[model samples]
Target: MANPNVKIWFFGGVNEIGGTKILIEDLGYDVCVFLDFGKSFSVEKQYYSYPNIPRSLDELIRINATPDASKMPVLQGLYTQSEITKLSQQKLLELEKSNQFKEEQESNIDAIVISHAHSDHYQYISLINRNIPIHISECGYNILKIRKWIERPSLTNNLFLLNVHTFKTGQSIHVGSLKIEPVHVDHSIPASYGFIIHTSGGTVVYTGDFRFHGHNPFLTYQFHDKILENEPIDVLLTEATHVTKSILSNEDEIGRKLQQAISATERLVIADFSDTDFDRFRSYYNTAKELGRSLVVTLRQSLILGALNICEGLATPNILKDETIKILIPKREDPTKPVTGERLSSWQKIYYQHLGAEVKGSVQSEDLWMPFKEMLAKMGTPPEEKLISHAQMLNKSREYVLCPSFNTIGDLQQVKPAAGSVYILSTSEPFDEEREIQFEKLLNWLELYGIPMLHVHVSGHVHP
Candidate 1:
């Protein structure tokens, strides 16, 4: 029988893709737990553009970029002290005028369970109160930690300070009277999971973004079998991302397609895909190896790979040890000088130092950046090696398969891809006006170099 005491609220992830925030309240136990407090790209784009973002937590809530704490007193104390202090006095007055103001107490929420590390699913976590423990998979936690180090510091990206608790698949987490069991599911990014919550009311299943058409379809199959074992579920929250789409492909097919495309090109081969999509990264890496071409990745991608390599059971290639893999360091302000710590960010300085390169500048104090310091310390000393410079990549264009994102596509101007060079768009097509504009810009860059572009992509979601 269904327990009437259990209630669910959909604060986001409805009628739009991403930005998933589901609140599961157990009235019988007098406790609440949130599932996946992620940002919605659609909602964010509605109000802000690049370089112009919400200045404070109050602004994010007011614009509906995140859940509105002012309207729901239950959410009143669920933000970090530093962030709440930044709320404008006018916003507080507005809350009081609407009879929605509540005294900020310790967080009432039991915990926030993250299903994955995708920005759409976990970006807003920085604004969450540190008192509220965040439960995530071990792989997801490591990915977020690395992202914090590489990304530029900002008000909305304080992920380093999160009070996190890591769990493995099948591990059960108890928050008040609720028991959450995270089960691994296949997705574009590693360490993705779905949750089966045993609440005071009933058993509810929430499927965070998942797909069965990737390298490990069996993982999603296992999740399905697990769901059947918990039959008579009172509620089921599942993703319907590709319900209307029919096109489908798998990792093996994509690998073969990539190899064929790379073999046909005699000159430079440029591949564009998500930085965190390790499955696609493997595909490109394997193709490069088979074709006797080095797989060149951006500094950010190299750092992500290095992070993944440290996590147990991921089997990621070590960039420092892999002879066929090369790190493409971006050009510094002084084009004449060799890459050094003085020209890099705090995290980049550490990475370059690890590569045995001469670092001239002082690193940032650990007092302000403990997480980056601690994470690097955990990684230990890697094999010292030299990074490939932009000039080196340009001269040896035919010897490498360059993987650059839209942000780094400008590098093509320096490489000036020789004739017969090809660009592969191994990612999804634009889903919105902003992305459409970016897509056009990418096309312009390829056209400028007279490089032929090919689309070879398999989605991270299953087809209907």
Candidate 2:
């Protein structure tokens, strides 16, 4: 019953957990749309690691990290002018010689619809041509913009000036012979969505990494009910990540476990979880409130929480207004001096200023800094007491439920945990060797401090 006019191609996300790229082409209308243009961690890891990534889009195409434009001539025009120029210079493709390349590097692909803001789902879009519009949920777009603002600038993260189009749940987008309607779904990250795509051939339901056990299970149920209304789905592209082996716990259970673990410790309680998992952040915040302790988070995480407030319906704590939450400012080379000079990045200075820190002279007047500054202004100024220094943290180890990642775990060297302190690993176990090595290093750090480790987590995926 497959419609001959509609051809579906799966360039990635076939046998891997991430790197999802699905192309839907309507031959009759001469329209092509990609469901998600994401990075393939598995394929990229085969050739490169961190600080050793591909030099150019040509390199990625050569290693099969991204779709090969050489094999698919239609994709040549879909790439950015700079990438195409580099490829042509390297003799990878002769698209530059064509007269069409002179006409703004027009794209055959109608659109690239992102399911969420997770790196695996939308990271690769940076390499594509900006002419091809990108459609993402309003919340997802804000999250990505904030992430790009905070992270170190790179070619791979050229998202500051993207031609992005943000939509809300139930908003339908038209892309020539197709209608893509994004429906909200419950996932570890906020603004996750599933698509009900209407094609000339048939209806395709693409479930983009969903679960029915998260804080917003009702959203998943609503997605299912929406799919039910669109019966006779010719194609069902679902995520079966946890079908074989799944965790049997929910957010409420994880929260209760967090409370129990923190309550048992009279000294410092260090919690480690994914930075963007706002639900998990809520759990830690509530636990700290219940235990009469302040929830201390890194400055980066505090900025993310502030940006997430742009999305309505997401109930993350207002860090600027929340008295129980505090922003943890790690010590610079000069512990006594305020964070300034070359020590702080551009976004870091902006964030510190937003938190009432004396970093006014460090901030620049560049246009790139304006959006973030304007956003912080709208969020209002955080209390000066909300900023906690590493020295202060060391002095008050017993009064905080500190949340730090492996990257920031070195802070423990300064604020050495007391005898009764405990470290809770609230994230999933390492799935690859690289992360396993990092986890082992983290364990070594804790063991050196004589702090016992406890694993208390619930998988983001649902139990099949």
Candidate 3:
């Protein structure tokens, strides 16, 4: 027999920013595994934008979720039985079936090792076969669990039932013929990791997504010394997200600019940024506390911050315990009726209870804003500091920093910020025409509200 050979095929994340899927097969052991089988954000617009999706595996393959696995016999179990039936009906099932096909195999994959919990890197995990053992860091898995709760539409409780094999950093996981060692790497999101694989053929190092100037550059250095420098690598796969251009600023520099903007503005300052970025969250949280103002956050953001605070190594501030942290429970946007617990879904109810937020008829009503105003009063501001109207917020523009996103632009219209108040654009700018249209619309909204928009952003990716 020929010497054992290793064949590597990439199903995604080739020439794009995300949607990475790497398949490795050790012919000697007749076993195969995957590294970061994630969905791509780029190809999505080619098919569906929102509220539209492929109903079955055949449709998904046509749109490119599991593109290469369709023809591979060994990976047939990755799809659900009903999905396989649909594939068979379409004559798209090319895998040779054995007599024992009546019983689904234990797994289509020997194992799956995930790099991080970013949707682009791990969104399609639900499509994987149920029996396959998923190996990920404890921190990464916890992030996924929190996401399942916060982002109810993307995933469900079914994810919690998967065969998860949690590991720690620097620990090795042994599958049939592959030994995968997860190495810690820093990224915009927490619990991101890279991998060092030992195969019969040679050693392989896969950098999922990394940056050196994050909250911890030392973690990236640890990865370099422990895996890259020590191991003799035959195949090295790295991400070049920022290879074409230089990074604008490190995390600290971005924080400094943000502090300046916050200090100069004396009104209700609103900063729009990526919620998954905990480092940014820290910076804003600290600035809000330092300036003696409560940082107002949305329900989803509060949950994410609460989760990260409990999670180890992140060093996040406990929003629940901190008097400076205030949860801004926006009124449910149904113009036809008053917002109440009866109108909320089960998840929304649980989320509200978790935050210990008081329910009122509407967030726009004085009753809803009274609690925060009370807190402000106790902080030495007078009862006259209460925000009753957009005019009031404008007059007291120096009191708070409201964190909002593009999707919640409707709320801004309700708040009707004063003319001098600033809108800090802390997230990435439009990279595509579709996003550019949205950006133009956002500017129009701010212009209509008479608020000046300021651009101060930092890239999520590292400078290569």
Question: Can you give the TM-score per candidate against the true fold?
Answer: 0.91, 0.92, 0.83
> What TM-score number comes out for model 1?
0.91
* 299-416: candidate 3 lDDT, tens digit per residue: 6666565556555776446655565665555443321222366665444554443344434323223332232333322223212111122343345568677876437577587677
> Listing every candidate in turn, what is its Cα RMSD in Å to the true structure after a full C-alpha superposition?
5.7, 4.9, 8.6
lDDT by residue (53-91, candidate 1, tens digit) is: 778877888878787776786776777765434443233
Clashes of 2: 0
Please give the lDDT score for candidate 1: 0.78
Predict model 3's lDDT versus the native.
0.67
Which residue ranges in model 3 land beyond 4 Å of their true spot?
A: 1-4, 82-105, 153-160, 332-339, 357-397
Best first by TM-score, ranked: 2, 1, 3
TM-score of 2: 0.92
Q: What local distance difference test score does each model get?
A: 0.78, 0.78, 0.67
**Ranking of all predicted structures according to lDDT, beginning with the best and ending with the worst:** 1, 2, 3
Stretches > 4 Å off in candidate 2: 83-103, 333-337, 406-408
Q: Regarding lDDT, does 1 or 3 come out ahead?
A: 1
